[model samples]
Every structure is written in C-alpha cells, then in structure tokens.
Target: MRRRFSLLALFAIATLPLLVVLAQTSDAPTCEIVAPDLGSYIGDWCAIWIRVDDPQGPQTVENVTLTVTTSPPKSKSFVYTTSRYNDTFFYANLSLPYGRLELTATAVDDSGLQGSHTIWVIHPFPVPYFNSFDTPTIHFFESWGEDLTNWTISPAGTWHVNYSNYHSPPSCFYTGPFSGPITITLVSPPINLTNWTGEAFLSFWSKINQTPSFTIPPTDYCCVEVSTDGRTWYLLSPYIVGYWSWSFFGRYSLTKYVGRIIYLRFKLVASSSGGGAGWWLDDIIVGNEKKVLVLDKLVKHFSCDSLDEWTYSGDWSVCTSTYHSYPSCICCGSFSGNKRYTITSPRISIPSVNDGQDIYLRLWWKFLIDQDCRVVVQLYYDGLWHSIGEFRSSLKRWRSSSFWITQTSGKRIKIRFMVEGYSNYASFQGLWFDDVTILVFNRRIATKGNITGWFSTENSLWRVTPIRCYSYNFSLWWGDTSTCLCYYGVSYPLDLWVDLRDVDHAYIHFHAYWNFTDPQSCASLRVCYDESEWVLLDTFMGARSSWTTRQYRINGGCVVRIRFQVEVYSSYAIGFFVDDFAVLPTTSDTASPNVSIVEPKSGAWFNFTNVTCVWQGEDDVGVCEYEVRVDGSSVAVELPPTTTNY
Candidate 1:
C-alpha cells in the first residue's frame, strides 16, 4: 500500500500544469484610454492605456490599430496605435476641431478581444527639459582675506587660538633641542568668528637645524594646542617635519575648545636621539578648519506606506524577514526555497513631510522570472496616490530606476510591481542601491545686485537684435558675424548693457519661441568679462524651441564689463527672444549698519584731553550719526554744539 501511494504522489507531481512565458516582441505600449463621458470627453490630456493581459502566450499584440474621430463626423481626423503592452495609451496631438472624439483600438490576438477609449486633447505645452542650471543661484562665500604671510593668520588678522606675546615677523623664533622644554605660542582669537565648531589650523614659520642627527622630540612635535582660559591646554596632534629649502617649517591643526579669545601653544618634547639640536620659527597663521556638506547626508528615504524609513539589507534586492524600525514599511523579499525577491508590503506609510525641495530617488531591483516587470511609484498628490513614473525590468538583466521628485507636497506614497512574464523562469539578483542625491539650485552668485553701468544691444542673429552697438551696464556690442544660411540658420545675436551697480557677473538666458513661422533651429550666446578680450563662457546649442535661462560666474568686482555675441549656423528657421536679465547679490548681503567715527577722529590723542570733537560714519544705506573723538580715544558722551570735554 505504501509503494502504491508513493507512485501516485509521483504521478501527481508530474501532472502539474506547465507554465509558459512569452517574450515581449514590441516596444513599450501606449497609455490606455477610457470612453469619453457626457456630450464630450470631460478632460483634456486624456490617454488610452494598454498592456498584454494574457499569460502562457505571446505578450506581443502585433499590428495594433487606433482610430479617433469627432462625433459630428468632421473632416478633422487623427490616428495613432501601440504595437504592444496589452494596455497601451493613445491620444490626439491637438484634439478634434469639433466637440467630441471617439477612439477604437484593435490588435491581432487569439482571444480576439477589442478595446476602445474616447479622449480630448487640450493645448499641450511642450514639456520643458527641466534644466537644473536655470537662473544660476550660487552660494559662493567670498574668502574674507588671503594668507599674505604663511602665519595662519585668520580673517581677523590673528592666530586661530590664544597665546603669549605675538608682536611681528622678526619677533618669532625656535630654540635648541632642549635640555629643557621648547615653547611656541601665538596671540589671536578663535578661527570662525561666528558659532563655529570642531578643529581649526594654525600655521607658523619654523626653521629646523640642518644637522643630520637632529630629531625634533616626539613630545616636542605635538599638534598645535588651544585653550580658552590660557590655562588647562589641549594639543591637536604631534607635529611632523615639513620640507623646505633652508629649514623645515611645518603647520598643525588644533581643535577650538574655546570661543572668542583662544590661546595656542606648542611645546618641544625632550628628545634623546636624532641630533639634540635647535631650530628657528616665524610667521604664524590661524583659520577655521574647512568643512564640507555631502549630498548623501542630506537625503531622506521615503515609503508610500505609514513607514518613516526604508530598510537596508546586507545584500542587494534581497530583504530580511524583519521590517525597518525607524521607517515603518520596507521592501520585503518574497522568499521561496533559496529564491529571494523584493516586493512591496501593503499599507505602507508616506513620510510626514517631504524634504520640501527638488529630490531624486534611485531604485535597485531583480526579477527571478523571465518577464518584463514594472514598479509603479505613486505619490500622494492632492488627496490620493498619483503615479509619478515607473521602474521597469528588461528581458534578461536587472534594471535600475531613477526619477526626480519635483512635487513638493503630500506625505504617503504607494509602490507596486507590474510583472509580465515572457517565460515562467524569470528572476533578478545582486541588486544594489547608491548615489541618490538632490540638487539645490544655486544661481544667485551669478545674478545679483552687482551691476556696473551702461546697457546696449550687441547684434541680431536668428531674429535676435541688439538695438545698440556700444557696451553698457544692461547690454554690449557683439561683433557682427554672418552665416549664409537662411533665417532658419541665424545665430543668436545678443548684446547686454549691465549697470555695474545692478549686476556683477554675466549670465546668458534666452528662449527660442517655436511657432508656425519658425519650425526648429539652434543658436549659442557667448560672453566675455573684458570688452577688449572676450572669453566664451558658454555656447548653448540644441532645440532653441523654448525659453531657457542660463547663468555662469566669473571672478570680478563692481561692474565687470562683458560682451554677448550670438552666432547661428543652422538652416532650420528658429525664433529667439530673451529677457529677465538680472544681477542680484550672490548671498543675502543685507548687513547691519556699522557706526564708526570718520570725522574728528584719526589717531590716539593724549594732548588735549578735554577737547570737544565731532565724528561721522558711513554705511551702505546712509550715514546716521556724527561721533566725537578726543585725544585719539572715543568717549560715550554725546557731542555738544559748543562744549568742552575732560
């Protein structure tokens, strides 16, 4: 009886249904459409979506045909079709001239099923090639001062830490590889003037003895030291010898433990080996340690469900049984035997709020079957989930998906996979995720209130004309150069007159309007900071079919004169128009008015101690007061019309 049962079990297993998957023999399918509602299709931008719905068969729906016609049977007719995607979307480019339009789709299939949808087309604006470099806002912090003397002098012209007597250059020196401790000190304030943290650097010139056996003691070469109270010191690290022509002058970095007044000290440890010799030191510098903000640090992971975070698996595409704790929902691997694949856990949570800026999402996935898969990522727009885009899986390889999340609002999002098997044995593996970043627009540095003077038109190319030839704050003359091509191949001729006070850097931004008169064309704008010599900052080419704003920065101060010359070398007619030329302050330059005594005050005076003096100050907006200085010193007492001071 046991042998008979075993035989029956084996037979049953062998009789199980054989699953078959077909290859995708066509391009990505078009959108499916729904029949028009009421008297006319209610919404414009209507679409017809389609996709292969059959399994164990050819996923390709060959020779698909679509016909769209208005209700009144007007001459206006538009037709388009999808070769594949059991569900494909189609729509008329410009809607029917009359009230309503009907759409029908038919494809060759064994099932012989037909699908149809009615849609209306509204005036569609050509999708802009979202340029992240639009309007160029730059967050360039101008270095306050240069390290004239290597003595790591900070912007305030002092060391980054506190120290002993620091007079001038010839005053600094180094002493012998001691029978005693060698002392090094500098006098100055902290590195970062504001709420700064972490370590800072202090540079000073030191001349070591050339004696071959001379070795600076390990303890003697300690990192520069810093202290808040001038006592209870802290050292950065042990010093290392730096290369030099005459002597070894090395710099060290020290952590700033104190703010405002800081003291720096370096002590030479007693060394018994490597030349018990001497050295000389001079020129000390102090500055804040450079800091960097990585793009990865600022990114926040998200899920459509109630989860706050996404899970990270040790292996790509393979998920653990457990979900992420911080971010509630995560991609869990649908495990079967040794097989593991990622799948969405239902009821996911969207984050409470988005980063509220332009962000990018990267997805890594693998399929374990011979099929084309799609991961539809939906964002909570308005009140429901709206599809932003989808991550698609190819025939044989694991594919990565990426898209920018431009929508700024709403929290929850939903992600689901659409799998169409060309063969039953489809699967993906070894998926990895990385390099996800959000780019914040930075263009202010190029277009802020740094204008000089003058405004003029440069030239006219491709219907672009600069009214004036002379260079000014708003415009400039770009030498005229012509191409034998008709109006279609006209170059971009643009002149800028920049008010030195109104703009500082020159950025070329313009839009080529595409209309019936002008079909397609390309042009470029060139700019140079010098009127006498021009350096081409950028040469914009490609479909000049839409408005585009571009910006570039050059190192200059006040009204740096520049020229913009346009050159077109295409035969295709293109229309070009440019405006919104702006030069704004790179950063928030709003500063508090500084009060200084400019008049009746020059130097320290002890002679006329009781003299009545008048003072004045200047500021960005306007001067508000006159201060009084007596004997090279300022007093809190207000100035009197005809008074005396003591």
Candidate 2:
C-alpha cells in the first residue's frame, strides 16, 4: 500500500504544475492599406501607407511589411516599424517600377499570428501596347485588373468574362450583377508617350445593351479616361449612358500625355434599379499607329468530335453539364483502388519507312488525384507500353502539355492515357482530356525545368513544392517521404533516378537543408540496374535542421540509375530540401578490350564434330556483348559478356 501510494503521489506531482499555468491567447494582427488608395498607384518613389491593429493590443503587433511584386522581376519588400505609424497610418516608402503591380501587406504579432492582404494596382506601361483578347495577361493587356480572361472572367456574364459574346471569340472583358449598382474600372497597359513619335490613338470595340434603369441620375454609364501619373484622371470620353451595339471606338488622340507615362482607364457603371446585359470591351490597340483587329487564332486539335474512335476500359464518357470548358471532353470520375484505367487511341502509325523527325504529342488536360494516384501518358510499341511522361500534381486549371516520344521516332505506335491508384483511398478525383494533337518536328521543343540533379520526380512523392526551400523559394524540392498503405513492410520512397548507362564509377554531389522536429527520416542512396528494381548503396540520417553538403561515390554498371530515397516515419516540420543534386561521371575507358581464347589446348582436341571453345574478354567499363565468329560464319556472335562457356 505504501508503494502504490507513493507512485500515485508522484504522478499527481508531475502534472500538478501544468494545471496551474495561465496561457495567453494570441490574436492575428489586423492589417489594412491606408495610403496609395490600395488597388491604385502612388508616386514611383513614394511611400505606401497601411494601418495595422491587433485584437489583443497594439503592443502585440511585432512586424508589418509590404511586398511589391512584378513578374519577371524580383519582388521587393519593405519593413514597417511602429515608429513609422503616426497614430493614423503606417508609412512604408519604396521605389517601385511603374506599371501594373501587386501589393501584399502582411502583419505579424509577437505570438506568430499573421494577417495579410494583396491588391493589384496600376503603375504604368510604355505606350503602343496592344490586346486582341487571345492571351489576356500578355504585354498588350498590361492591366493589373482581374476583369480580363481568355474565357468568361465570371459566370453567366454577371459583369464577368463570358462565352455569350466576344469581339473576337471565346473571351472578352465584361462588367455587373446589375441586380444593384456597381462601378468597375479596367486600366490599360503602360505607355510612356514622353517621346511623341507619330500619331498616337486608342482603338477598341465596345458593346452595351442595357434596357435602361429607373434611377434617372445615372442609368448606365461608361467613359474613357486617361491618367498621367496613375492617380489623377482626366475624362477623355464623356459618360455615354445607354451606349448600344458593338461599335468600334477608335482614333482617340492620346498626344496630350506626351510628356509623362500614362495609362488609359475604362470606367463602367450600371445603376440597374432595373437591368439588362452589361457592358463589354475587346480588341484594345493603343500606340502611335492604328492596327486592324482580327479574329483570334484558334488551335484546337480535335474539335469536340465524336468519341467513336477512342476506347476506354472503365467508366469514362463525354460530360457536358460542367461549367468550365470543352463542351466535349473525355472525363473519368469513377475510380477503383489499386487499378489502372486507360483511354487508348486508335493506331497512330507513321509511314513504313523510318523518318528522322521527332514525334510529339500535345494535349490539354486537367486532373485531380488523391494520395498515390496519378495520370500517366504512354505509347505502345513492340508489344509494350512505354510511359513517356506522368502528372502527379493536383491541377485545378486546364493544362496544355507536350511530350516527346523518346527513341520511338520512326516506329508505328499507339498512344495511351491512363490513371493509376496505389491505395484504396475513399477520396474523389477526376481526370479529363480535351484534345490531343500529334506533331512531328526536327527537334524536341520542350524540356523539364524542375529536374533535380539529373533525376525526375515524376510519379513519386518527391517533388518541388513552395512549402520549403533552400533557395529560389518557389520551385524547390521537398522530397516528401511516404509509406505505402496497401503494402505492409514497404515504404513509398521519395525517389528520383537518372540513367547512368554503362558507367560504373561516378560521384554524386548535392546540398541538403533540413527542418525536422525530431524526424525519423532516412536519406538513402540507391542504384537501379534495371528500370524497376532498386539496390540500396547507403543511408544517411544525421542530425536534423541544418544545411549540409553531401557527396557520395557509386560503382554500378549497365543501364545504371542513381536514386536518393527518403522514407519518413513521422514528421513535424516543414521540408527536407534537396538542392543542386548532380552526378560526375569518373569512368574513363578508352582502351580496347583484352581477349584471350582458353579452349582447344595445343591441337589435342576431342574427336567431336563440334568442338567446344571458350574465350575471356575484359574491359575497364565491362564488356557489353561478346561476338564470336566460328571460322568467319558468325555462329556464336551474340553471347552474354558475363558468361564465356554459354
């Protein structure tokens, strides 16, 4: 009884302190833009203003920052201190480029709570930019507005991009629920008319057919305005309410803003106390010269045609009820675990004679997969299926992709699109295909950019994610290690392999940056002789959360593939980063093979019709094949180099 009482007393003592602790609740800091009138612009060298507050108290706010972003240019960040806040605003002065920009304001409290907001604004663009509505974000459509889309920007044309109407086809900018009153403005690409070269004019097509509103003050209105500094605007076209038809509004002179950088504004409003179809504009051309607007070049490989030529083994059919696109698309929604569903194409055979041009298959597709599920594009040749490429990421937008058929340039083949599941997951996923186009070219056009070292993370859990990185934070490798759920005693290695192809000696160098909270992880190096089976060379599981330079030497041959395998038992932290993984081939085999016969000893052979003969061959890189010509007749020309008596 004394021993039991003592153990109980110790247990109570161990947890007694935890019961009396007071934990302070942390609230995310509130962040709001106070200056530059967010979603617009300020001076190129002026400061940005923001207002930050914390629910706990102002003292809880630790850091406030603003990130000015422009694609193709490195983003810049500015810090905000409490000293910069003058009771009403937090000022962050920065020198930013003129044009369309995105400002992201973030606030962090002392307890790591954060709040952030991002808004797009106009800076300016050099004049003469053009837009034909084919590619909305192209340089010609340099507006930081969400009102532009190649397709419908919003749904059902509720002041959004819709399929109902386009100056071209398939896309346009629209503005309004019209259920109430709304005002939307779209800015044009930057134009620096500081150098007046020739005649400068604005050209576009506009359409509006509202059945007038009951509000007499301003029923529905659209006007063209010009801004020299992106903030102060001067009306160029009077507010034309109840503007009708798809009329060409053109030849408006923009020579007045010749001494400064400028941006054209399209301001639209609808006071639809009673409403109708909203306003739309397309084919915007602004410059020192006028250009004709033409139809958008459509490049659809297979126009939503019949599916009679395609064959599928699972539940795949044409779907039309969806709102997105591809009025006719091959969709596969039904799934079975540990099974592969494929959609096979009819025979895609080249001419009997071998042509030298490379074969490419380009298509538009979208897919979403659960754990261990993937979509693989394959080609069937010589009675086998070859996986040329695979997609593992869960993509929401439609993707256009092209893959080269490696080494099958002159062969007759058929293409296969398949989806595979590795486990019995209950989550729902979908795979859809819009069109497939086959093209032949003298050279391959595309290359994989995210190849870590010489290895590809296709069809593996190891991939490049923005979660964590050692450098270039966006597309760095995370090497997420996974374990197989269906197979016991097996782990799904975060793996990437490269073909060494007959080289037996090489050195691998890479950088490892780890952020692990007592992780039970393994960084295993392996080699694959054949395409499938892998052999472990070594494993590394040192201390976690540090940057280390890793170098490994490998000795393997003949279709050799190097792999970095990772298996995670459990994880608590961000990422195990793999950077600059590369291999250095050290094999220098330039000498000829040394061969010596070891049979028919000194003319004392047996009295047999066919005498058995043997020879030994050796090379620095190992012999690929043994060719033996019996009296110049090529009797045993094809033999394995590993065997001399076969």
Q: Root-mean-square deviation of each candidate, in angstroms?
A: 29.4, 29.5
How much RMSD separates candidate 1 from the native structure?
A: 29.4
Error of 1 at 554 (Å): 14
Per-residue lDDT value at 177 in model 1: 40
Candidate 2 per-residue C-alpha lDDT over 452-549 given as tens digits, one digit per residue, 9 for 90 to 100:
12332234344544333333222334443333222222343533333344455655555566643443655577876565788776665645555555
lDDT of each: 0.35, 0.56
Q: Which stretches in model 1 have alpha-carbon errors above 4 Å?
A: 1-222, 242-260, 274-283, 288-646
Candidate 1 local lDDT, 204-225, one digit each (tens): 4444442232344443342456
Error of 1 at 321 (Å): 82
